[model samples]
Target: MRNYFIFVIVVFVSLSSSAQHTIKNTINNVELITVKDSKFFKGDKPYYFIGANYWYGPLIGAKNGGDRARLLKELDLMKAQGIDNLRILVGAEGDGGDSRVHPALQYEQGKYNNELLDGLDFLMAEMRKRNMYAVLYLNNNWIWSGGMSQYLEWNGYGTVPNPFLPDYSWDDYLNYTKQFHSCIPCKEAFYKHVKFIMERTNAYTNIKYINDNAIMSWQVANEPRVLISPDHETAFADWLNKTVDLIESLDSVHLISTGAEGKASYLQDIAMYQRLHSNKNIDYLTMHMWPKNWGWYSINNEKTSTITSIQNANAYLDEHILVAQKMKKPIVMSEFGFPREKESLNPTSSITNRDNFYKAVIDRITQSKVEKGVLAGLNFWGFAGFAKTNSENGKWLHGDDFTADPPQEPQGLNSVFASDITTLKLIKDANLLLIE
Candidate 1:
């Protein structure tokens, strides 16, 4: 009788331990991406990717409220083409309706819409199924997503005071966006949103976000900048340091990035840019190239303008590459795109200039890979997939279906659709070399 009781107790203890081990394995099923010697790694292999800015992915993947069918098709499409990384906006804030960036996940402070969060879960779950990774930006520096400006308005500030106004100056917009760095209440509100998101569980997989490997990194904001303001620049440095540390503490598994628009954050000051990224918590570097926005191209003079734009782009890439190499960190051209010939948004329009532009960028990346340089990857401006706008020749307006085009840009501009075979091939060919 004594031997029988002892045997039963041993069996029970072994079963309990086995159960615990199973639960742990189930909760942490995915492999986390790691960084070493300035390069990203998955296990022992270098992690290089052909990615796209599917910023509207979560919105389209939301259950009942979004277009899930399209989301699945798009993911499958990207997977088929060997695209492996997706950069998406986790959520947007504001009381603005579809007139602004549709599907504001957190319109009021502390008031989150679970539907959107569930949508994000669905997106991540689908990406996991496809073996794709995501880089999610937590906030936007611009009002397109009801970003810093909206946060201020929520705190009793009046209008955004944007420079786009006929009478207002650009300095006004710069100063307005700059205010966010120092506003303690605003920062606290933003932090709450971050914590809430970090702590939330994915509805589909039942896996906590911190443990989910679908996410590659958490970007602090989209194109955050100090915009040449001395005081604001100082404050932003502090904010970046603290914010990255906070994210690191919250989720030690994933990487953290500033989501800065490269030299734009430091007003094209290379030294300042380097200093900003020197923080130990900042895992890698990012930069963006906008020939149109920076006045390197003109719509009226297509051939000449495009040539100049491409030249300028190459120079920009070269400079950024030197900077990244000096810092000994991998760099991603997170955003780069050119409009169709003559800046046309027409689906059937010629992409001669755009194609050449993409090829140039890809060639640089491929060369860098062969030489073991610092440039690691490139994510074009966006992927619109099958979504379309109501008007072919106008800015985005309310009542039109939301495409990949953000609210701030003209409809259909910079959207890489499934029909863009040439562009797709460029991406695929470049991706194949990296994977091989």
Candidate 2:
């Protein structure tokens, strides 16, 4: 009798485990992510991920002349820390510059560097191996990444109204990029690039790009903005809607979203934020927060400024959450970070304030998750794991291994690495508890 009972128990347990595995596979195999009551769903399971922006994942994962060792190690580290999603750049358009990643992918009209595309293929293949998902931005709104201004220049527009220029102010740069909304030829070239990426088959995985489950979403651009121009508002809407439609037609298996920095819309009009994302085809909403850019924090004075920045950040998140709730869609805080204490970039520098800020953000997300709120995901500004500045001044020089820190910013400014023990622990703990 005892032997019979033992066999029965073992059989029951095995059956239960098998059932769970089937359910997970079914969810993971879904063609497109669907929405259900403000939560993102893969089949029947609620989907959430603790993610990071590894914008250079493709470059590092490329098979031909790519950093395979570093890519493998970083992906291993990220998975070990409970990170399941990564937001990476698909590719950038236009020519390279002194302060940016040289030998860009799409430097000329309809021309591409096959090396970078292979890099993205390797990235997706490896992410699939780790059960990781990717949010691939198709373009960038900033100049550092050979973004929109490059497209404008490609169309015989005399100068790019260069943002990095000493004479140009920040607003001027934004206004210049806003023109990308109306540039017909520039928009057409961008669509071509998108189709090229979406239609390709992964060399490493033997899976078509659209069929690959590793891709979670295709973002239109990084933090696309309308600026203060009234005409550009109409233009931005047209561009966003058209782009989402184009992606949907090309690949219905994957999800699509706009990389808009919430509430910072050219007009700061909350209605525009709501209206822009109301499109049926847009899978989810994304928002980015920059305490330093918004003037809520000062890099020079970490102590007092960090305190105010945290407060401002809290309010900013809450506001976006309310908007997401109203729209009845899942939202991700796709970007948020603080400079090191005193804004130091050294590997050994203290991240005390930075850790505190992360804790606050995680705690809020946790609270929202518990409440069943609209916030479903969080991908901090970057994860630079082990990469350091190549230059003595702690700046990113040409030929340095690409880090999560973009060229527009100082190297190591917001990168969270393995050495950040306290911060890593907080992130891991949050990831473990915040999901079902």
Candidate 3:
């Protein structure tokens, strides 16, 4: 009888122990993205910063659609180069009237490019197979077609929904916005989109990644900013905040990010908006800034330009990062690049050397408290671009010339400085994932 009791007790103890042990693979998607170590999250997990920031019509199955074949070819090579995150673009309103909704969800008549959906599908699958994460950027400052774009004008400022789009007349667009906003399919659509993204990729699982989930998180927007203009500050901020809320309300599973446009006011606005909506709603803060134009391109100042533009950026990062660190938000650098144009402030400056600028700036950024804790990841400027005759040329991207000062290979200066491919290998050696 005593032996029988002992055996039962042993079995119970073994079961309890097994239950308490957590498999890192079975991590809570929410907790996995937390900035600090809490009861729920494993904060000590080493970070691997790898990614790219591309906007416009790169992923939406437009003319230069990102096909699965091309995406896989790129990702496979980059994996060797050390890539972990691919920041694909998603705008507030779909580019074309009937193309935005996933084909599966869109009415037959509304369906445009199923290829975009298929490409996204392929991407998610590849990442999961490699145990990687694809951070899908929800929106960027763009409007290729209709709806909320009728009122705004194009300006270099990050004010309004998009520079190319029309401004919002709170009196007029609000009703339309409310109605449009209300129409989001919420949870059902959210899950369907994500599930499709995951399943489509899962079609070709390898032995190393036979079973896995979708990409990492759903980024809120590309670079939402109010800028020096007081124009769309309130409305844009409000819209972004609501987007975060809606995403969270719909699915509490995947992590969500605030793709805050990098600027003094924009960062402040996003932080404020984030607080108002719910601090915990955001997994982290990701923004884009080119201090060279703003003026901090080089600490050395090799370039001769007004220091005011750069001073603000240098000061802002130095100051805010301290606070952001305390908040424990992971830092994800979605975009960082210096224009190669001679007009670029950082061009040929004491502070403007490519390697000098990127290396110097990034070193300081990574050393910050927030960087050490949660913000250890960043995805720079863009991934791929061709000199192909762009449709947006002369119209929208007239100034976005990839031509170098002497016109080297497009983003040559910055690209050579970062040497993303090599950087990834270096980062990986240290157990960090570097994708861009």
Candidate 4:
């Protein structure tokens, strides 16, 4: 018995030492995404490409309702099309309420749904295999993903006043969410979540997340905003700085981004956007544009408004790019989407207007690449490859297919489907230029 105990102890120590060596080896071998002189580089080459927002990746990667075959097929399609960089949601929080993502990664504070966690691991493993990189946003400012507001609700702040519901206004939701910045327990719980995700070792690859090159950056949140009032600025900045600091301290390898939506999220003040992003820990800048949401486009005046939308978008891009140039950090137009012609959600609807908008945006990135400008990359709203959707009413049912549009919105509002040949061609062409 004494001899057996000694042997077991020796084996355990040897295994531990082997694991440590493997982690060290992986770290040394991995070529992480790095920023130098306001541009992204993959090892030694300048890296830029047209990517997609595939936020439902983990959900589809899940073993339960997840369609791994679909996930694999979609990934293959994306890779073949030169759409390599993906902006993905790391996970959602709370119970899957109305308009919120289902199969929550964290159903309770500090308690996670292991299946979703496994799904994330599987997603990363598959992405690594394809030589793709992910920009994984940890939280969301909106209620659609049970984000900051969910944290507030979890800490007994009151039930989340979802704006989509008839009872609550957008102002009510924003006012409630802003409180999260100052809530001590809410912030602490969020910090715990950040640590939990960052410290994880991939089940499939046997690689620590800190050492995985598959991740391009760890985004603070999906469109994290100051919300409603100027008074919330200080608290928002404080929370943001601390969060980025925590992320930096945990993993000095991967890059950190704020996932901000430029002036839109900063009370329409570009200076405020610049000031908050001045943190040394923040390695890059990100901005999102929504022509329809921002009122730059109108369905009533389709043709004229499409032109107006393009002009406004160009100005927005230029404004943000100037900030990026001054800061000497790369900027990515991470999320932008245009609805089909006449605001139709049908897959077969004319995408002529959408195509034109995409071309204009892609052209800007290509032009920047030529001039070596700070506009490093862009990921259009989303890709919903091979997912069949009900086009009749465009309302997304509980078990309906995931698309570029979030659950709360019309199913195909801005989704780039596998069958969108014209749009895919535009994407492919732009990627070709970027690579050249």
Candidate 2 error regions (>4 Å) = 1-33
Candidate 4 has its poorest 10 consecutive residues by lDDT at 23-32
Ranking by lDDT: 4, 1, 2, 3
Compared with the true structure, what per-residue lDDT tens digits does model 1 show for residues 241-344? 88888999999879888887788768788788898899887888999988888898788887888889889988888888888888888889888878887767
Candidate 1: count of backbone clashes, pairs at least 3 residues apart or interchain: 0
- How far is 89's C-alpha from truth in model 1 (Å)? 0.9
In angstroms, the error of model 3 at 234 is 5.8
Cα-based lDDT at residue 364, candidate 1 = 85
Return the TM-score for each candidate structure.
0.94, 0.90, 0.60, 0.94
lDDT of 2 by residue, 215-297 (tens): 88989989887776656778888988999999999988787889888878546777778888999898788888788778988
* Model 3 alpha-carbon miss at residue 154, Å: 19
Off by over 4 Å in 1: 1-29, 163-169
lDDT of 3: 0.44
Question: What is candidate 3's lDDT per residue for 1-436, written digit by digit as tens?
Answer: 9999999999999987776564333432222333444111224455546455533222432223334444455556555555556676532333333222222212231232555544444555555565556667643332332222311211111223432234544334333322222233332343343333333333233211112334457776455455343455555555656667776776576677766643443545545533433457777666566665455544454454324434554565555444456666655666666544342322232223333334544554345433345445556655443322222221213223221111112233333122333434433443332211
How does residue 295 of candidate 3 score in lDDT? Answer: 51
Greater lDDT among 1 and 3 belongs to: 1
